[model samples]
Target: MNEKLRVLVSVDLDGAKARVKTQGHVTLQSIQGLYDVMKRADSLVPGLALELDMTLAEVEPQALEELRGCARSHHLPLQVDPLQRDYRFSILAPTLVALPVAAPMLAAA
Candidate 1:
C-alpha cells in the first residue's frame, strides 16, 4: 500500500489566547498540546508517517532530546530540520532526549 506521510509544520501556534508580541512566544504547554493532537492522529491512523518541524535548531539540545524520547516511546521517528544553512542533518530525536539532561524550551504562554 502506498501510504502518504503526514507532515505538520511549526507554523506559529494556532488560536493562541494571550496577546503576545509575536508568534514566537510559543510555550511548552502549547507544544505539549500539539503532541497531544499528533498522538490522537496516530491513534486514529496507525502507521501514519508523522513529522514535525525542529523549532530550536542547535541551541535547544535538551528540548530536542525530550521530544526525541517522546517520539521513541511512541515508536515514531522524530526529526529536527535545521533552519540555518550551516547545518543540514536528520538526527533522530530519541538520542537527544535520552541524555541525563533536560533542554526545556519555554516562553510566555
Candidate 2:
C-alpha cells in the first residue's frame, strides 16, 4: 500500500460517498488533483495544520472548530475545492463545486 494519502473533496458526506463510488480504480492523475487541492488550501492558509475528508476522523473536534474558525476568519467558502480541473470536467462528471450553466436571455425593449 502506498503511504501517500488519498483525498476526496466534497460539499458533504453524501457527495463524498458519490466520489468513493466512482473510484474503483483510481489513477495517479486523480490522486494528483487531490494533492493539488490540498496544496492550494495550505498555500492559502499557512501555519494551519489541516486534514482532508478521509482524515477527519483523526482530527480533534476542537481543532476542527479552529479550522472552521480559520476558514471563517478568511471569509472563504466552507466547502472544499472539487478535485475537478475545470467546468468541462464537472460537465462530464458532476462535482460539488460545479456551477450551473446559465442560458442567455433575450433583451427586453
Candidate 3:
C-alpha cells in the first residue's frame, strides 16, 4: 500500500459548484496536489466544498488539522467524517485512492 496524498475534484453540471474527495496518508508535507485542486476549483468554480472521508486512513488529528488548514487557506468549505465507513474506492478514481487502505474484509485477520 502506498502512503501518499491524493485529491479529486467533482463539479456540478453547471460548473458553479465543486467539491473534493481525498485519500492516502495526507501527511504535513504532501499537500501540493490537494492545494492545486482547491486552487483550481476556486478559480473555476464559485463555491468549493470538501467531502473528507478519512476513516479507513490511519490519520492522526494533526494530519486532519493540516488538511483543514489547506481548505481554510483556500477559503473553501470543508466537511469531514473521521468515523465515516461507507465508501467504495473505485480503481478508476485514481491510483492513490485505490491503494488499499484496509485489509480485505473477507480475509482473516
Candidate 4:
C-alpha cells in the first residue's frame, strides 16, 4: 500500500522565509512529497532560503538527512521546527507559492 505524509509549505519572498512542515513517517517512498514541495518552492522563488518545520513529523534519521540534503542542494537555510506529533496527507498537485501576494499594495488598499 502507499503511505502519505502531510506537507505544508509556505514561502515569503519579501520576508525571505520559506517553510515546509511535514508529519508522519518520512520513509524513502514517502519522501517524494518533500522533494516535490522543494521543487515547487524553487520554481516559485529560486535561491530562496528555507525555514523547515518538521516538528509535526515522526521522521527517521534518513528523513532528516534527506531534508538536509535538499536544503543544501538548493542553498536554502533550513530551520527544523520541534513540535506537533504525526500525520498522513499527500498531494501530487502543482504547488503555487504566492507569498505575500503584494503586501504593500494590499496594505495600502
**Whole-model Cα lDDT of every candidate shown, in order:** 0.35, 0.34, 0.48, 0.52
Q: Work out the TM-score per prediction.
A: 0.36, 0.27, 0.49, 0.57
lDDT for model 4 comes to 0.52
Which stretches in model 1 have alpha-carbon errors above 4 Å? Answer: 1-27, 55-61, 75-109
Candidate 3 off by > 4 Å: 13-15, 52-57, 69-109
Query: Could you tell me the TM-score of candidate 1?
Result: 0.36
| lDDT by residue (tens digit), candidate 3, 1-109 | 3476566668663635555666666654455455556556555543434354444444444545665554445442233323222221111223222222456578578
Instruction: Rank the models by TM-score, top first.
Output: 4, 3, 1, 2
Top candidate on lDDT is 4
Count of clashing residue pairs in every prediction: 5, 0, 0, 0
Query: Clashing residue pairs, candidate 3?
Result: none
Error of 1 at 105 (Å): 21
Candidate 2 lDDT by residue in tens digits, 1-109: 2333344543333222222112222233344454345445444434333333332222223333443454345422233433322111111221222133379998999
RMSD of each: 16.1, 17.4, 11.5, 17.8
The 10-residue segment of model 4 with minimum total lDDT is 85-94
Candidate 4 lDDT over residue span 17-76, tens digit each: 577776666665666666667656655665555555665565555556665654444432
